[model samples]
Target: MHPQYKADKPIDCPICSMKLVKFEPTPNGENKPMDSMPGMDGSSSSTSSQASNNTIYVDPQRQQLIGVQFAKAITKPLSKELRVVGKVSFDETKITHIHTKVTGYLENVFVDYVGKPVKKGDPLFTIYSPDLVATEQEYLLALRSNKELSKSSFEEVSFGSSSLLEATRKRLKLWDISDKEIEELEIEGKAKRELTFYSPVDGIVTERAAFGHGKFVNPEMDLYSIVDLSTVWIIGEVYEYEMSFVKLGQTVEIEMPYSDKKSLYIGKITYIYPVMDAKTRTAKIRIECKNPQYTFKPEMFVSMKIKINLGTHLVVPEDAVMDTGEEQYVFVD
Candidate 1:
């Protein structure tokens, strides 16, 4: 067998079953250097080849000519990085679902479309709730009675009237009536037939359940969903084997493959979903990112890399190992 090629001890060709033969080099300087096969070292013309039981000796010239390289095995901090596909999602903690406390017919709708930007106090819709109007009327009647009885000779009578007025005022407030509206009611001495609802926060309306004018609605009906995209969530998945490296509050690098900037965004893992996908066998992790300029949109796909330190360990070049099916080996020199 040649020093560089693997062969069975019986010295027979596996394919043709031909008996193998061995040959030695000719007299020195008698022949040009033989061509070398790819992956195998180039033939050395400087000196004849020499081999022992399991190792071959190649001179420095031939080793350098074939681009043979060496790397020192060392102990160093190591980290494993996994690139994964992630999708943008709404930060559930920052989402507000608009629901009415009163049952009534929608009188007017201001925020009628999804994707509309709204401020914290922007009016969302108005409802003509007979119940709301009735409560306001009761407040006005109590207000008038309290004034008329304040000068009463009996302290009990005056106190009772004041108590009734305060109770009615509290009821309206409980129904989500703004203090400004209550003051307007006091000045006007009348109840508003249509009670307007306003947005609770500055956000974009990702969902709107506009029931239309004159359509009856109740507390069970979801009127709108305002999402504050200034802070968003990214949902990513990692293989089960990589789950050990992930942790809550771990920082991750996020990149949008479709974006022109190719900029990297930073985020922290806020949640690790308990559900493991049966098909993909991956666990979902939620990362919270500040969406400056509303950069991330729901359902937008992005790429992310999760890096986890593995402490100190010895390492070698990837090219060092050569696998032979059942076993693996490497050339020492």
Candidate 2:
């Protein structure tokens, strides 16, 4: 038996009835000293433990295995890009409402359908009003009276007939009659039962109240609403905290939803609504964009991005910062 493994008393194997040799257990044919392990009382190990508490040390192999990366902090110009959802809408300034100046019945609708584009002076509908016909007849009668009285030797009779004719022509003009129509009436020497109404501006018909022909229309009724799509507005809601960054004339990028196109629409911030939405805590901003192609339609969902220069800032990797529920912190190397 080895002297290092010798026991204080002799022990015999039960089966062999002979003295048995005792030995210490060895793992992998070696025994290690406990003090040589980590967290031991040795000075070197103690220092390493203390340093590890303040610093993280990862070997190249471990770092590669964990996919760790590093970045440097530097001073540079920075800009914050705020993203928000917006809606496309019509430019109200270019909208025109078509209304009848006199009570009438819609005799015929030339530009009959909603969304149909019309130009200035294009015939929209013809209206039949008894009062309008009466006015036309009165003007014709006054013109004939003037012609007959012009031969009267008395100058007063000639002047009075000229005044009556002038008054009658002015009344027809007040009723929205175009000068061309009145001139044609004088040449033809007749009054038509219906007068055709023309569009006042170039635009698309957005709303139409005159559906069926011969429907009674009053001066108060809106017969048609036309909006010019050459210019449009994109209205976006921005958070109150981000309102300070918004400014008039700032250019923004707009992206349409569910579109396969990669190019974004560019718009300029034209107006910022003074009031904020109480429930949403956001303010409204209007961005005006040109729609010469007539691609943007009203009520379309869109996304907008506005970039604001924040000047110089200390920049770091986004992953370097840690955000706690109540606060934010970062680890320094």
Candidate 3:
């Protein structure tokens, strides 16, 4: 038997029937009780002795070494700010594609370059189509015939000439001939070899397929793609679990990549895509922001922040929580 097991009053060890020793507290204030020793069967006696609700005791030196911290549980309003990355894009609703309605040879290129700003009715290009010229000549012939037949004594001849004139006018209009151009043609009493086409929207040209003068273009070809940048969209995705916190009209803060703290742009959530992405498990969202100064450009990456007010609730430091496989718990001081 170990000399440390010697005692004034011999007490038998429950495990080995040997003389037991009384326990003494160590300098660090930890006590090794005899009952905590292993039994004769080599089973931990403390396992059966310790209660499930027992407190876990740690010495001050060990606590200091482990860097344990304490925090008070308090009720306070908690707001969660969700940060996400987004990409700047042009507003789809404001995008316009200009396509020719008739086959023609691109005669003149006015708005020649991409990114050129243009307004509605601004001349974009001129096209020369043989069919369009023929239609114009037919309209002129009908106009001259109507004038000559107006004095006819036969009412049938007058009505027939009037019908032919109206039919020719409708055909020219169907061919995208503007009323102003038609009136000008009527005044000049001649056909223009080339007709100028104007932009239908105010925007910057984003794409131009027409190259050089006299390129043969058909109605199926997209001549120009214009995108109005007055209002732009910030597209982002959020975890599907956080979908409830997002709502239409919610204000979002957009920050440019590598921008300063004061360079945040404000926008409103316009849409939340209903479908969730299978791979990312996220839902897409759209935010609309005014870009009158053209500060935001398409394809630029930005950061978005949204604050969700969760109201007052109990809170604790994140480090305080511990997961023990089956359950989560926290230690309180």
Question: Top TM-score: which candidate number?
Answer: 1
Q: Model 2: per-residue lDDT, tens digit, 43-87?
A: 233334445444444433334345667888999999999998998
User: Per-residue lDDT of 72-182 in model 1, one digit per residue for the tens?
Assistant: 877889988888789999988889999888899998999878899999998988999989999999999999999999899999999999999999999998899989999
Whole-model alpha-carbon lDDT for candidate 3: 0.84
Clashing pairs in 1: none
Q: After superposition, how far is residue 125 of candidate 3 from its true place, in Å?
A: 1.1
Q: How many clashing residue pairs, candidate 1? A: 0
What TM-score does each of the candidates earn?
A: 0.77, 0.74, 0.74
Better of 1 and 2 by lDDT: 2
Reference-based lDDT, residue 19, model 1: 46
